[model samples]
Target: MNKQQILRNRPVGVPDEKTWELIETEIPEVGDGEMLIRNKFISMDPAMRGWINDARSYIPPVKLDDVMRAGAVGEVMESKNDKFKKGDFVFGMGGVQQYKLTDGKGFYKVDPSMAPLETYTGTIGMPGMTAYFGLLDVGELKEGDVVLVSGAAGAVGSVVGQIAKIKNCTVIGIAGGPQKCNYIKKELGFDHAIDYKNENVRRKIHEYCPDGIDVYFDNVGGDILDHALTALKKKARVVICGAISQYNSTDGMKGPSNYMSLLVNGAKMEGFVIFHFADRYSEALQALGRWVAEGKIKTEETVIEGIENFRDTFLKLFSGDKRGKLVLKV
Candidate 1:
């Protein structure tokens, strides 16, 4: 039997148990061109909240009663596909389930020997790819750039800051607490960390980037993004990543009041979906894989032990209860 979390309802505020229900069904049969994967780790991200909305966006929303969409790494248990063999490790949009059966449309082989399987679902998978394209390509990061990153202890934001440092940029990170702030500074080697929960965000940013910021990698949007705008250098780039702060608002999303600062400073704010760079994934994977192997990039994952705990684990994204990647181990 396979246990899958099916979307029960579209959420208005924060998602809760009512949003999805776990149900068991027979293990699916692999067809002539299909494979069956027993999911090992299911990625829980802030972006999952956006995926459940019944609204137009970059990707189609997860339909009600369908499996809750997610990225996962697993081992192939049965396969009739020529491209995949039983026991091969793979990564794909496996959703929040104990097993997946597919024709391998978006799936690809992964090497567990290269890194841990769960790490692929985090740093070496979608979140890592997102950080690579969001910062280097969209932010146009350069050496000596003063980079500001919000949600710096979370999956995508964490990678963004580290890659900035690797590129010879001075990186400042914004996280929710002293512990997370210290994690970024002490563990991740960020030049400075602002504890957004305890400090005055604007003042701390001004203190850290006294002159101006060259790149701002935004993950937790809303007020922090507005404050970041006020400190942009001339021709600065703002990479608009996930907006965790506004994803669950019943009142509506907040727009930055300081957006005009972009015009004043001749800076640019751009948004992108990682799927647009699908063709270049190998570039990111190779670089991230190399950095991980060289000790230049570090990964921290909080693994919850069951598919049934999906909702509880997912809420960690908004509550700041977990640092780094949050995943459900099946």
Candidate 2:
């Protein structure tokens, strides 16, 4: 089996091609209560950036020379666990490798007929769940409210906007380019989209969300969030899912200048990690799947072929080069 390992060093800027070292190794046997998953698709997320750093987080950092951490949708090629069978498609936190041996800590059997196996690792999976709980639960979204989302064209953001629209909110998405902005508005049914690169985000926020934003789903939490903060209604809510913009900051992330808006508007802002809701993943997945079947939400995935491209593919999230949920076809 071929696996990618994090060679001796950590990255300073973006993870480059040289950052990972690919090696061939003998496939291992499955132990009792374990199964070997032959990976098909691996998920690339902005959160992975936090996992590489040596810091205190919800999860531990990857050790040097360890298999690169990731989530994958794969088939059970071999198994000893009574819960799984041969040829069962499953999803789990199975790093960037061709095959994984799991003791069943975080693995679930996937029904291929339910949806495409790849979708399970993206829209109907973690990203979808993040959008659901982060917006409706944490943000306390209400019907007829005005909603603004940063990183609005990516995985979680895209799902956030469409779901907000379904709940009768006028949604405005903030992305980097015209194509992304247009896709969110024209294709995803968002009420409006602001290309932060070309437009004054604060001005557009005021124009599109004339009633003022009642819920702000923040994914990219730097200047875009700062701009969104200035256009809040009284008793508004901000759900912090991620801060992609500040992840690679060399000088450290600057505090939001418009935070006083929260106090002035009598609003609330809170940060949440999705893993805290692991117990309710199934609930979110079932509801999101039903929405997809009813044509209420459309999911997008930007798939990059080959596990060898992991470094370049992962960097795409920071560069604003991907259209939707970025995944690797391993």
Candidate 3:
């Protein structure tokens, strides 16, 4: 029997076991042009928090009683598509399930020779793609630019900071703890890192980015976003990839208090939904894959083992317990 976690209720705050129910089910069969995959690793992301709400967004919210939405890396067990075969590893939005059936619509075959199976979901996968387009295309980063990123220790944010470093730009990362901040600055080679939990965010950003920010990659929006906005230089660009801080807001979303800086400096801030660039994903992937192969980029994944821990694992993002790309090993 295949086991899956179904959303049992909408969460008002941090989700717990009560928010989801684990159920046993029959194994799904492959249809024409479809493939059946046995999940190996499942991605747990901060964005998953937003996906639970039934409000409108880039993708539809997961319906009640349906398998909780997630991206997974798995081995193909059966295939009716010429593009996939048995034993091939693949990755996509396979949800939180022990088994997955894909119509080859949103799935991609994984090449382990290039990197590990888990790296696909971090470096060569969604988080990597989100960082790439969100930084280059949306942020319009240029050489020598100073970039500021929130949620700097996270999957997408870590990559965003690293990619900025690779492009010859100065990078400043904002995370919740000293350890994560140190990892970003020392290990990841970011120029600066601020621990929002310890230091004054606005003051640190001002001190580190003395010339003002040239580009801002926002992940955890709210006060940090307001801080970054206040430090934007003339013609600076801000990319809103995810506002994790506001995802579970009971009072609704908050805009930057320093948004006037945009008008004053002629800077621009744009919100991006990664799927909008779905057609050009391969273009971004090819370049990003090359960087990963050459060690110009690094991928970090914090995996939790078990399908039964889906609800608890997902809440890690909200609690800031996850240090990198959060994934569940099912």
Winning candidate number (lDDT): 1
Q: In model 3, which residue pairs have backbone atoms overlapping below 3 Å?
A: none
TM-score of each: 0.99, 0.97, 0.97
* lDDT tens per residue, model 3, 119-219: 88887888999999999999999999999999899989999998999999999999999999999988899999999999999999999998899999999
lDDT of 1 by residue, 1-330 (tens): 999999999988988778999999999888899999999999897888999999999889999999999999999999999999999999999999999999999999999889989899889888999999999999998998999999999889899999999999999999998999999999999999999999999999999999999999999889999999999999999999878899999999998999998999999999999999999999999999999999999998999898888899998888999988998999
In model 2, how large is the Cα lDDT of residue 283?
95
lDDT of 2 by residue, 4-61 (tens): 5555456665666666787878899778999988999998889888888777898998
> Each model's C-alpha lDDT?
0.93, 0.88, 0.89
Clashing pairs in 2: none
User: Runs in model 1 with CA error above 4 Å?
Assistant: none
Residue 146 Cα positional deviation in candidate 2, in Å, after optimal superposition: 0.5
Model 3, TM vs. native: 0.97
Candidate 3 lDDT at 107 equals 87
Q: Where is model 2 more than 4 Å wrong at Cα?
A: none
Counting clashing residue pairs in each candidate, in order, gives: 0, 0, 0
